[model samples]
Target: GFCSQSWTGLIAQLCSGISIVCWLCALTPQIYLNWRSGNTESLSLSFILIWLSGDICNLLGCFLTNQLPFQKFLGIYFCTFDSMLCFQLFYYRWWVKRRDSQLLRSMGFSDTSYHHHLAPSSSSPDGQPQAGTALLAANYNNPTAPDFFEGPAASGANDAFSLLDPSSASSDSPIIGRIIAWVCCGFYITSRLPQILKNHRRRSVEGLSLSMFIFALNGNLFYFSSIMLQSFVSPPGLLLASLPYIIGSVGTVLQDFTVFSQWFVFRR
Candidate 1:
């Protein structure tokens, strides 16, 4: 429908475009944060990997169903971004530490010194307990301190898992596409839990970026709006066709709010 004849259609397209922009841009902040901090310890690897898995399903589902070109493009874009996040996690969690370990060995310091140098102190030189260190260092005396004490958590997770609109599986598509769409929904829903649990277990969201989830919330809201707007003016089947995407976006929104609440409860 042309803009002049169908305002709803026009608005729906506008919302969809906005959602694409938001979703594409959402992961960059977290990636940059990880790189800047020289670590991804604040984030959960499972969350990113699970989201990447969902994007793979979304892409395959889109291709199998012969969905819109842009939908397929979005799927590819999502997988690529998720891969980048995964690379950052590897670099920070494994590569960087390995590099440092090698350097420490070259300088004749053992692994014990490496750990000692990287560990944070529970108190400042002035003798006051640092706000986060005391709680994070509960196992400081143990030789095998847990990873959470390695550093403060990052300020965010990419709703990157939720970015793909798995709704590309229209009613006319094969049953496989619809099944994959639902599977993508499950991945998106399950992806957030690990990070939330990480935040809860640590009782801190110090380094996690609230902005990442904020962008995610906005993206999902607009994505859902576009689908609903289209459903209102299009045939009733349009609603059914878009069900998986609707559920994915809505479920992520509620989970995003849950993450937001965690921020308040655990903000340092």
Candidate 2:
């Protein structure tokens, strides 16, 4: 009865009803991979990109709805997860590229394929990796299958959530509350606009490889659509919810176009 305060309050109440146990446990596969692999070679960057995009909308939603807790929840959730995924991917890419560069210099191997890490299920006696080459690790020694599905949690400091209709603070002042909310949301989502802009720019998706585009184009469309329907369709709601998704879709399309163009041109 008390939970039906508003859509934001209701959704927050519903979400908060669940235990964090289920939430964290859902991430076991990913955490396990990151721990064992020490790399993120198989993890799709677009997964996090779309996730971050949703977080952008969530940040805006939390800001516009005056729901500080949910907004902060989304912020912390996205940042922690995105940062870790980014870290893993960054190192993996850097390591591979650097290693390959070194190899080119030291030896004569110039292949830049994923085969280095993905050596398939079997091996040969000639000190060569087998075919299929679909595995995520550089070898079985460091598997990256779990890297593709990461999950990060909120820190302990945020565990103590705010109680509704608190008696301690004033029940009258919206000024400071609004300011804090705006400032907090602003600090959170500002970092993501660049990628959105880059996609919006018709620039080369070269830095964004084809594998990433394929993975994200499919996965993120689902994620983006889910987030879109999850929120209402108001001014702040629309801006916070719809705009980033539109940007994401457009970006994905543009990235696809770029990739397709290259494919067509190269084919000819």
Candidate 3:
């Protein structure tokens, strides 16, 4: 109904588009600031993971619905902006690594805060030990455990899968839209979740949010399942949605054991 514009179809779409564009521009700073700051201290992993997950679903829906008729100028615009969001994710991850490295170095610690690395959890050099690390530590702690060590054990299952959504892959969904949706939403969510969960459980506010994580996790998974169930899709979309969940679930589970975190002045 809303999309079926009559008196001002172009006007409505353009207006809504403008609003979205402005919102995207505003969010660019959040990532830019994170990069500048060197950590997602203020941001929460679960929240962002959920946020990214929701973003993916929303983005997919956006691409599918919006780009259907207008794939030329508008299509290109949507693709470009969505791609920028993906860039933001990688950029954010890069920012995390860079700043985390510098900070860890400053503190006389040789630790990398990604999923691959695993170390025991005794204490930290300075402030509270990141609950994210602790959350991740649970899995990595046991030498027998499979390498699922990232942040807090929200889901505990690091799903490294991204099955494409058949609904989006159809002739109806242009290639550009599908591509943008997967790349941006997938990269952004997958990279951020473990870290957010990691911090949430670890009690580290240095890089990332608990509220954001809490709300986002719920919103994202709900949105994903909603879309999936509505159409009864295949493994692709299901897998795409599951990985971040695994990450978030672990975080939630870890939170059961980890302590609380206090909001700081200038975090991610």
Candidate 4:
């Protein structure tokens, strides 16, 4: 019994260490891709937001439920990094929009008149405009033109802006945030569904960062393993309490793997 307990403890420690490393590195790939691409359109905002919400919930849950010190630390770290990613998404979106507006202005096209001037004419050859020309005009005049530019042209310097007001954080009730955090925990668990559906609908993972999901898979696997190992050496009651977290990590692993598979299959 002593040997088994020792072994389980060792495994738990190793898994937790690995999980932390994976979590730390997981977002780097996505961050690099966003910086390189200069557009967050391909990356699902909902996914990031939901993940952020989840991290908040995870942090609070750990604190409320009296999880291990390391687990609580991991939650804090995850929340911090998740928030960074969210901020990055917001920054990239704003930058792309501003850049597009500037380009339109440089071309002497006012937002109001741009679409009107570029609209397809009825008197074109064969009483129909060329498909390519019409598409190009439509893109230029589209209010959400930034959504289409997923290339290097969309890349721009980072902008610093907070999505939420500073005052809100300072003045808002802690109870409200805590309530939202619990809600976000649920959001976190289900957040991947939309992304999976998106990949299926598009049949392409063109804009997704492959490394991001790969790292997520690694992190989640280790996270689940650590928890399971710890639970193995603990009371049955502890295991029952940890079931939700275990399920969450396992679910995340499966979803992340599905996404990684999509990346592989769709890359062709």
| Candidate with maximal TM-score | 1
Please provide TM-scores, in order, for all candidate models, with all chains considered together: 0.76, 0.36, 0.31, 0.67
Worst 10 residues of 1 by lDDT: 137-146
lDDT of each: 0.58, 0.35, 0.35, 0.50
Candidate 3, 1-268: lDDT as tens digits? 4333232334323333332233223234444444455333334444344434433443344434332222223223433433444455555455555665677668877655432342224354333433323211111110010111121111111112112324433555444433544443344434444554555455455433243333333333332333333223224454444444334334333442332333442233
* Predicted candidate 1 versus true structure: per-residue lDDT over 1-268, tens digit per residue: 4664388767766776666666766777777776667656667777777777777776776576665455566667767777888887787667777788788899999977775555433332322212211101000000010011111000011111122234434544546555775777777767787877776676666556676787777877877776677556655565565566667777777878888898887653
Tell me the spans in candidate 4 whose CA falls farther than 4 Å from its real position. Answer: 62-73, 110-185
- For model 2, the superposed segments whose C-alpha errors exceed 4 Å read 1-16, 19-21, 24-28, 100-104, 107-268
Best by lDDT: 1
Model 1 misplaced regions, further than 4 Å = 1-5, 116-172
Alpha-carbon RMSD, each predicted model: 11.6, 12.4, 14.1, 13.9
lDDT by residue for model 4 over 1-268, one digit each (tens)?
9999888778776765665566566677777766666545455666776676666655564454333455456566666666766776677655545665567889987865543443334443322222212100000000000000111000000000010113322343333433433354356456776677766666666556676676666666765666567666655654443444455565666676777787777666
Model 1 residue 215 CA deviation (Å) reads 1.3
Q: After superposition, how far is residue 217 of candidate 4 from its true place, in Å?
A: 1.1
| Pairwise TM-score winner, candidates 1 and 3 | 1
